[model samples]
Target: MAIKGSGSPMEAVDEYFDMLIKSRFIEMFGDIKTNSKGWKCHKLGELGSFKTGGTPSSKHEEYYQGTIPFISTPALGPNYIDDSAAKYHISKEAIENCATTLIPAGSLIIGTRINVGQSSINKIPMCTNQDIVSMMDIDKKYDLLFLKHCLNQYIPYLDSQKKGATIKGITVELLKSVMIPEPPIDEQKQYVDFVEQVDKSKAVCK
Candidate 1:
């Protein structure tokens, strides 16, 4: 796969990592992707493993309050999770008995059901419930925030899948199948900077 620069703003809004030829896009859709750049594309599963978290048994009331933060689907935000944001905490004993898993800080976590598209990069080690999935041990070459955005970018497709009483939200198999853009770290940094600048500008306008 070829490493690509983030290219112009033209490359930013591509459909879930589909790097169409800039010229072809212009010829077909007209001049919009004039600066679109090619980027390496990969399935989310190929980049890292998705670990679904487990919830501690409620029967064990002792696990309800402790020092270790316990993350739930509600804790997930669209992009960032703070170290102080977890609403529940668990005890070491509950972790042992209940077999909850703790992913490291910097891992990108996303909710799989209920509020489906919620996502964020956890700032500390924490355990999430079964309703969420974490990209544990993400490949070092990709930026965490960048990956979150890429995943978030794929959310609409996830939502478009038919829902029913049996399957109301994103499933692991579906989530794993989405293709994502893999730009060079340098290009990713540029994308990050571009986003920050846009945010700051919005704040100034406010």
Candidate 2:
């Protein structure tokens, strides 16, 4: 059966699941308070390396028209990502010089400059423009999905701390200092699994 919103029950379910996940997340982590200097803090560069992306010089004919997915800040939407609708592409040569560091599938891509903490996990290997920050799991100890949730939790605070007048931005240092609860990997996976199941159930209900 289908529901009214977004023309499909699945869409309605997805929206409901998103809210449920957020609420559950706060219930799980909201009370474990920490002082500003007490939590285990590390700079983003220390945890994982990141690099900016570039535009394949449009003047050159060979710079584009290939299978590589080129993503920009605007592509990171509210809930879903539309990879097929990406705006640009690059040749093997452009990939070599411009976006050499390929963001592996499932890694979190964060927008640091304008939007601050907006992030999404790429389901396929892709490259991003300068405005995005791709974070790979350095030690496999942290769940990528959990980290994404943590980032989402911190967005409002990060936005409030923006120092730039004309162009607000968060430095690598600031991002790193943002504390995250270091739960066991198994527990993290369980949380993710539970959320996924809730999403599935919502879909069925709708």
Candidate 3:
């Protein structure tokens, strides 16, 4: 028979299967539930330097075709990140004119104002428009993948706390005030490695 929080009898059995995860992965998961008391909190700026990119004037034909990856809002997708699909390309001359900072691979790229917390790691060196925030890990204390996961986890909560009528954005102050669970560096790496493997496996299944 169907049980509470279960869809059907069979589904209830399926749900119970996940209990094995709790038991088997006990070392990886724990309840340190608290009301944001002892966690070390910092603003986004404090975590890394920020850079914004500019769009080359579209009317200029020279900006239309070249080899550089010019990223914009839409390229940041729900799942798989395909960097090759950016709309604009520029020659060396155009690059000098736009002067946008080229982000390196592994840097955490976040959509700051419009999308708030949506983020992805740049798999290649690329440039982005003003709507995004490029974060360079300063002290190497935080893993970019771990930060990305943390951002994804808290985005809904952050969006709910956002205060604005027209723009609906998270302010720099608010972004900075966001709290993160700062476990030891080893623990952070462990969590990131575990999630990365799971993500890779899921992608293969798709």
Candidate 4:
């Protein structure tokens, strides 16, 4: 998979490690489509609760004036996101007025529209726009990082299945029905540890 970029040295380095990490995921869990390893499969809906957020009405000028971080898809980082990652902020009244919910810190924020499959674990409680859905109160049996990677593995397929000719997106039902292999808790932890080591290397590169 060739990643197109300006070909600067820094960009090249990042791309190399990014590809390396992707290849490592494939090594750990063969093709997710076939479940070649025969791990137990479970629908994502069975693993947690899903909440889709809403955008505050732009008609109200006061809605965007408060301290609460209003995270949208662009703010989602590869693994974790904090207040600093967000570009917009809103007031509590915005939450009350809009259909959005106050997603607690540590919840997994997954993009549903436009940039479907992009996700991150929020390090601060935040509100999101209509384009994002969050997984909250995740089942205790599954490791959050492991589940994040599992969702990421489905990105290619999700991208292909996206609807909308203008602002491509996937439905919440599709995201809920997506199946992922469920390895034992210990194995999931082991994968997380490996990821930490690789991330340390990525940090060094930076």
Higher-TM-score candidate of 1 and 4: 4
Q: Ranking by TM-score, best first?
A: 4, 2, 1, 3
Alpha carbon lDDT of each predicted model: 0.69, 0.70, 0.64, 0.86
**Candidate 3 local lDDT, 54-100, one digit each (tens):** 77777778875777788776676332344565777666565677757
Model 4 CA deviation exceeding 4 Å by range: 1-6
Clash pairs, model 2 backbone:
none
Residue range 88-111, candidate 2, lDDT tens digits: 766678777664456787777887
Best by TM-score: 4
- The lDDT ranking, best first, is 4, 2, 1, 3
On TM-score, the stronger of 2 and 3 is 2
Model 2 is weakest, by summed lDDT over 10 consecutive residues, at 31-40
Tell me the alpha-carbon RMSD of every candidate. 9.3, 4.4, 5.8, 2.1
Which wins on lDDT, candidate 1 or candidate 3?
1
Residues forming the 10-long window of minimal summed lDDT in candidate 4: 1-10
Clashes by residue pair, model 4: none
Native-vs-model 4 lDDT? 0.86
Where in model 3 is the C-alpha error above 4 Å?
1-37, 77-82, 161-168
**CA RMSD (A), model 3:** 5.8
Which tens-of-lDDT digit does each residue in 1-206 have in candidate 4? 34576387677767877677678778888877789888899999988888989999999989999999998888764788888887889999999998899999878899988778989998889999999999999988888988898888888888888889789899999999888898889988988888778778878977
